[model samples]
Target: MNKKIINKYTSDNQASNLPDYQQCYQHFKWPSVTTQLNIAYQAIDSHLNTSNENKIALRWLGKQNQCVDFTYRDLAEQTSRFASVLNTLGLESGSRIFSLAGRLPLLYIAALGTLKAGCVFTPLFSAFGPEPIRSRMEIGEANVLVTTMSLYRKKVAKWWQELPHLKAILLIDGAGVLDDGCYALSKLMENANAGLPCVKTSPDDMALLHFTSGTTGKPKGVVHVHQAVVAHKSSAYYALDLHATDIYWCTADPGWVTGTTYGIIAPLCLGATMIVDEAEFEVERWYQILDQQQVNVWYSAPTAIRMLMKAGNEIRTKYDLSHLRFIASVGEPLNPEAVVWSERVLGLPFHDNWWQTETGAIMIANYASMPIKPGAMGLPLPGIEAGIVKRTNKESEQATLEVLSEANQIGELALKQGWPSMFRGYLHQNEKYQHCFTQGWYLSGDLAYRDEQGYYWFVGRADDLIKSSGHLIGPFEVESALMEHEDVIEVGVIGIPDDIAGEVVKAYVTLKSGVIPSEQLQKQLKGFARKKLGAAVAPKEIVFRQNLPKTRSGKIMRRLLKARELGLPQGDISTLESDEQ
Candidate 1:
């Protein structure tokens, strides 16, 4: 955990898809684009003629211990039936379909079926309240909604009538009293033909619309096209180390970008078996799934990892996880302690990666065949070109960029344009989308630096930097240091206004299960942080909390903490999953 590089692990018989990074990057080529390029065809129907047709495509575990499996042929037929249902409803190509439900078997079918019919698909968090659901549906101009009867009644029943573009509502769980334009999905699928052909689509045709929340505005819809599957297939092959025979499990809900890109599309494109659990995060339940289902490759977020760390290592000893090979973490920066802890307790280090909703695919990652530097974002993917740059003009119509040359020079992270999965544009916000690029580089708002060996390290977000007495501080550095403390389980740092300095660092801490919170322990933590980091970089003030504000995808809401502390407006709490007491 002392910034020491973990050497890559190799077996005598097994080989990685990317044996050497440079060689693969030099010879990498995108798949040829044909006239009829559809994601559904690539992910599902194309496997119909191969041996993968009989392989289990999905294994769904219900909340009540009900287990169901769907093979490639079953998926093709069910998705085709769903497409025919859409066709029978008079929905044309390019129509928008939005789904709001938990991880049900039918939800997966609906998603692939929507893409098969050449309609745009968007998935909403089932836990979202009424306002968030209404706003996203309104912004995306939802033409069809797929949900359960309970969700429709609780969240969408009252306000859905106001949306003019909504034409149909298909309830997965049939309702006793149906409203206008509402029909049970089972009834529609009963008579629909299962031989519906996949619609022909251009590479650039819109296939998915993912909404991302901003700090002070309505949710911005990020548009992605059918061509994204090319990047999806390649990135998964190299980054996730996925193979046709692997049992893959990505524990992200389809509401967020990671869930859709990796959880649903990427694995399917490679013909890998996917494990989907309809229950929320429970340490014992998750361990049971890994041991019983024999998942080979596991993709998860840092929040769940921290939760498991908090649960202690005793539970893991009861389960046999010999089948698990590679584990990867995303959604946020993985703390160095988590990486070290996983390696010691779980027998494999969690390889951290970097990407955003706009990218629509993994850009930087610690590959299975590469050495890992704890707390680093790893190297850029084979096809990605990443750099650090500084802005030249702040208040001019034509701003410019200066690419930093020296290593360890902190600057905004930027990516060279023209990646296939790169978002085409923001829906109805062309000006905003155009502002994201300058000199052919898409500016990522996150701040980062690269070491001499080309390993990228994440600083906090650009706006999250702390300027105290002429010293620039990234909250991630301070949080990682504090996380080394044995008593601290989770930490969220923010900059608070000070009289002498412009801004000072303030940290909110969540302690371990049995640790008592006393002023002496707080002072000890401050001293420990000061020892790890210098006085200027350490937290000026520390506060104890039961939990920190987080999104449904498990990213800490540092901006929310700063706003609540300063009594400023808490903009866009729609995605807020939990709040600190």
Candidate 2:
């Protein structure tokens, strides 16, 4: 029999003596699962039935500093009209709709409208170049695409016809006559009725498709169901201390899971007023937005927090953040320094939380009411069961995973597989999806440990992917892109520690036989990578290496590369073939 460890943070579980899962399910009110459920209806239409119909659902800030406020009623009408347009276009139920825009109102409308239409909504980062956009759309079998005209012309125009499955390309900000196969989004909305009925959807129906990169392959698409709304609402209420009427802002792009889950769905489900800024991260502007918007609850990434820290205290002191009560950081682990900095400067400690694209929602979080553990990732959300497990059979493809009972033992972080928000499976990758779970636990590739108080601490990734500025960059993806360049023969990419970003992508490359590693060549390679993979996934620094450490099987030892770069202890490496000194 396996040993299970359940540590108690508080001694109040007397009535039922039930586990956290039962306690949470019994404590919170979940929508009736027996009836049909649509995330859009739960997020928008339900609010419309309440007295809060006129309440502000979204406050969108335009690029020119213009503001547009959408009430629950207004949002419902807009989303219904968009859904009507989708139906008019002959898109079938369960069709996949992809959004390739930024934090615009139209993108949010498209997301919810797609959900209301019973179409799976997948969002891509607006900064993504032609290839990433094309690959994701192709993988998800995207039926309808909603994006701006400029993005279409810049990124999608060339490849739009290549995807046979893509039927419609709706341009949100298009003016003048529509392109050959494209339609103006605003004109379609104008022509459609605003009273379309929401599609009846089962809880298990696919609602969202999110793409995340692995260390060694193309991006994997994770599927989430409409039932995920249950966990999202509960987590937002408990983890974020979000309240109805509270002005909230989450600094994540709609392209990412955090953006879709928290930025759009969670706040709306809570009936909170959400602030959306159409601008990049500038310290002064962010401070001004916080003050002017009177934001009560704020969620951001560790990279942004560190950047704010770099901006110094004088800039922050000038702004009035008196309205701010809670601030939380996600995307990556929040360093202890940033947490302390937030407490001292921002007047509140930045709560840290942990989750993945596969989890579909936040699994563990530092609550607003709980005592702060600066660097710890906090306890599992009431219903989530997290454990540290060791692979007892690493040599076999099918390994035996044993959950560690002792506290503070370093091992892979694994979560029990029953969360409502947990991803159903990786799209079209049944074997890969099955490989992720063993002994009924979803193995998170991250290495972490939990303290006796149940606070989980992040160690490092078990894989070689780089997380820079809250974006996951696969070394394989970057390496493959760099290998496309004429001068590069082989490349090993690793993340190096930085004060601002938790890690920055750094590449160590070996040139082709005749090609010399010159400064000009390095610059050209960097430019090529930026062009191919986009700046976010491109390597920030490049170093010329005679050769990269590899195993006898020719697998690049990224761990050795990272260890050598960071001057960290190089653990046992008896299988090493050779090192380039």
The 10 consecutive residues of candidate 2 with the worst lDDT sum are 1-10
The TM-score obtained by model 1 is 0.80
Worst 10 residues of 1 by lDDT: 6-15
| lDDT on C-alpha atoms for all candidate structures | 0.87, 0.88
TM-score of 2: 0.94
- The C-alpha local distance difference test score for the whole of candidate 1 amounts to 0.87
Which segments of model 2 are wrong by more than 4 Å? Answer: 1-32
**Residue-level lDDT tens digits of model 2 in 157-189:** 988888989998999998798778799999999
Alpha-carbon TM-score of each model against the true structure? 0.80, 0.94
